[model samples]
Target: MDLVFVFPVNLQKTKVLLSELSFFVNDEPAVIGLSENSDKLVWTGRLSPQKVLIFKIEYKGRGLDQFVYHLDPSLPVKNLRFISNIRGGSNYDYAPGVIPATAIEPHDQNNVSLTWDYKSLEAGVPVGLILPSEKSFSMLIATMTGRGWACYILFFISIVILTIHGGKKLKFYENYLISACFGFFFILLAYLAAFMNFYLAYGLSLLAVSALLYFYIRHLLASATAGYVVLILIVLFLTIPTLAVILQGYTGLIYTLEILVLLGMLLKLSTQRFFQNVMEELFGIL
Candidate 1:
């Protein structure tokens, strides 16, 4: 599915782009879970943008995934002619006519060459969307259920590992306990937000977590409070968009992986700078 060229390239931007230009559009609701193939672009017209199509024009080493999009097509001014060459074949093999999935009428093939020299289309056009059948949909649903939730599970596990590693490093219980407890608080906040809103979930939760983190770290690290606070806030702002990316469909899983990596680094740092005397200090160094 080379996104470089589609019906949008030459057609007018109609209020109804895909359905107007293509035949056999259905009224029933469609589900768009995710697309993993390369060079693929999904189309969602009119209805809350919820239909999906994974297009593959030619076999490729890799491709791209796209969400359903609503684009208007009835706008004027463009070329309608399309042509293609067959691999290792004669010129006659290119019989141009009405292509599939397109709404345009195919020119009469029976007519002989007479008045105009308008060239025939040399390629096949898709007539309309061809989605995965019911069986495929059933299988896809199962995969989504298991795999999507699995990401959450893996995310939880990473947090646990980091907490354990961080906890083991402290020679005293007080500082170690506070840091570990705060980290746990952030993890709980993350999944807590996930249930309500998919897109905003990670971002809001991460903000809550990061603010708590940088503040605590700043209080403990040195005496420069204001500058550290400003730096901490700036980093939190920068992290918000990254968390948003994590919440995005399909690819957001990568963002979760990044979170895990960061957690690991955080844990590693905690271990290296473990506070053995912090608990004793709270007791006036005993």
Candidate 2:
């Protein structure tokens, strides 16, 4: 056995092995030692190497933004396993001086589990998790603003490509309308999300904007290329960037990979007659 201390930190209720103020040893009930420190509950006992010991603690508390576990820096850690179950959110981070979890498992919808298993860990490492909190709409909008420049660039490039592929240059007013339709997608999503599920909002926005672009392009170009332009715009300007925004941590890498893939596709298309003609015309102007 080992000495255990539970410090009172705004905890409303605490339990050991599902019993209030109860302790157990080797499947038998045990008494807890009284602590002189009024702020903490302390217990100590001896253990047999042959017997299995299990300690389970349940805490009902609030007011703490993050939970942390401290390990003795001077002692070597062996055969240590830590598991945490979180509900309602998956966006989390590691606290300073804490090692990342070895594995993350999805427990259920809106639940996640993090595990850290170490066979022979050196001294001085601690374990902690910075729990995710609910984000306000303003905060989410700010985050989108910070990471959305690439999406705008990609949207503009798609429009330019669509213009070239149509073999008809877009008038200034037509270009403005394209830009307005693209911007309206985000505006519609933001408003729709306030009263409905996010996925539903996103889907509605995508469909609405896609239909608008299709009809507008079809009216202007009057070609089968309208469908291709809408498809490309949806994938490059909306879907991929939306994924990158949702993943958050992998934003830069996602954007870089997306840009490379788009460039490769453009290079491949450049060998085609229509694309070659467009490129020659574009370069001939210079």
Candidate closest to the true structure, highest lDDT: 2
Per-residue CA lDDT of model 1 for 90-156, tens digit only, reads 2121123323322222234321111111233343233222121112222332343334333434433
Kindly list the per-residue Cα lDDT of model 2 for residues 1-286, writing each as its tens digit.
Answer: 5646453332333321112345555457766555575545455666667665565444422233566677779999987777777765777788988899899998765678888889997894777698766545445545665656767777776677677777778778988898888778778888887656577887888889888888888777887667666767778867788767767789899989988988998889878998788777767755
After superposing candidate 2, which stretches have Cα over 4 Å from the reference? Answer: 1-132, 135-138, 284-286
State how far residue 276 of model 1 sits from its true place (Å). 22
The weakest ten consecutive residues by lDDT in model 2 span 10-19
Predicted structure with the largest TM-score when compared to the true one? 2
Count clashes in each candidate, considering only residues at least 3 apart in sequence or on different chains.
20, 1
Error of 1 at 11 (Å): 47
Model 1, residue 209: C-alpha shift (Å): 1.8
Off by over 4 Å in 1: 1-171, 178-182, 225-286
**What TM value does model 2 have?**
0.51
